[model samples]
Target: MSYSNNAVKVFTVDPLNWQPWVETVDVKALTPAQIDVLSEAPGGLEKIGPYYALLAHDPEVLRERTRLFNAVMYGRGGLPRRERELASVAGSRVNGCTYCASVHGRIYNDLTKRTDVIQRIFTEGVDAQLEPRERAVVDFSVALTRSPERVTADDLQPLRDAGLSEAEILDLIHVVAMFAWANRLLQTLGHPTRDEVVLV
Candidate 1:
């Protein structure tokens, strides 16, 4: 999925229907610094889509941000992949970032081969009833998203009780926290709509 600013393309199953809340960096005219950041992106520029393109307006920050994103969500170990994706979706849903939530939900469904829980979440929320394990993760994520400062050691007991190790707990927190930050950023900088077609 690597691509240069001059020739960018990704095979998409469907086109997005909205644009960024703020203008995105012009990938076709990326500066050298921005190009470097895009290169460090996990799958290169083509995989970044509009969100990272917009973030790339500040290359130094985007580079570090992308590195952390790739490591926390895509890197192996600790939490199961589905749980990590659940954390992402939960945080996004709690933060009311429908676009991010939906994207993660689709990935979660694909990975778990089940859409029941995700459907409940999409139709209801992070608070929608879930399996005990899924509920634990979502509860932790929702708590963090709604009130991070109030979180305490006691707040972690559920995840611990749910069979998550300390490392897994750390990964879950990272996933939720990252999405909490990113969800707000996207809410402010981008939006979803079925009103128009945007062919990337």
Candidate 2:
């Protein structure tokens, strides 16, 4: 299907798929380097999709991007995995990146069993009511995503008060900041497709 950002409705927490605006590299025609990059990507070669295929056009860039994303979101011990996912969801929501939000929201739900939180976010938005810690996380993510330059150390106080340590707070910043770039890339390069809304 053709890609268009406007095609995917907002507030959809269901798992979604992307469609690239430009032609994607054919898996069969991939160079050895491109194949190597996809092999190391999150889901590996078997899982590479249109987004990965499109990025495969520049194997070096895609390799670095994939590594950075994996390190930040899937690396060990800085921020709790759930919190990292939460920051991602919050940032995606604020940026209106419905596909990103949906993907990460599913992960958050799996981690926390709090489908209610994702439900509230999708239905009510970034300002939706949340438990204190979640509220702090979502608030900070929103502020950073909305305007990074305006954020100050003071802006970090809420997260600190919510009991996050310096390391966790730093991790939060990294995740949210990464999403700001990720969301934009997803929106600018393609959009969520409506044809297949996988509920998994």
Candidate 3:
């Protein structure tokens, strides 16, 4: 399904405008009691801003998961910030998540100042016009996201050859994997993209 121009606008605004044809759950507008129920559920709603109220019900577990995800993305992971963003964009592209593709494409463009590269990755494929290292990262991300069962030592060797350490390679894999999960969730839940919001 194609995204409407206003679909993204919903995420840009505080109060979401639910579409008439789209039957979606508005996590942002839940009542206090509804928030409590979400907090008690498996995927704590607290990670997303609209669901923050759920923290009142179960702060500890939600906090721990958020912390670990943050650490993996920003702390101990040796993968460079730009590379991580590239991996995220690549995975989101393969998953057909326009929202995530736009978000991470903007990030990659801002950091690398390579709009051409971003355009190619989005319009063409991840393997379109990347350097060896960038190509390795994109290839690895696509492989891990699309067909993890097919991944082997040979699949990882190129990333190693591209100068990424084992830890950094694993970090890249984690970022790709996480985004795969995130892309599915956001797409399934009909989360809209706010690409015009300059995150940089």
Query: What lDDT does each candidate get?
Result: 0.75, 0.86, 0.67
On a 0 to 1 TM-score scale, where does candidate 3 land against the true structure? 0.69
Q: Could you tell me which residue pairs clash in candidate 1?
A: 21-189, 21-190
Candidate 2 weakest lDDT stretch, 10 residues: 191-200
Stretches off by above 4 angstroms in model 2 are: 1-6, 196-200
> 64-113, model 1: which lDDT tens digit per residue?
88788878998788899999998888787766666776677888888989
In candidate 2, how many Å is residue 42 off?
Answer: 3.3
Predicted structure with the largest TM-score when compared to the true one: 2
Model 3 pairs in collision: none
Q: Each candidate's TM vs. the true structure?
A: 0.84, 0.92, 0.69
Better of 1 and 2 by TM-score: 2
Off by over 4 Å in 1: 1-18, 46-48, 195-200
The superposed Cα distance between candidate 1 and the true structure at residue 57, in angstroms, equals: 1.1
List runs of model 3 lying over 4 Å from the truth: 1-65, 191-200
lDDT of candidate 3 over 1-200, digit per residue (tens): 34455465211112232222233235667656556555554456654332233233344554555555566567743999889888988898888766667767777778888787777886677669888999999999999989999999999999989999988987998898779766775576454543332111
Q: What C-alpha lDDT does candidate 1 achieve relative to the native structure?
A: 0.75
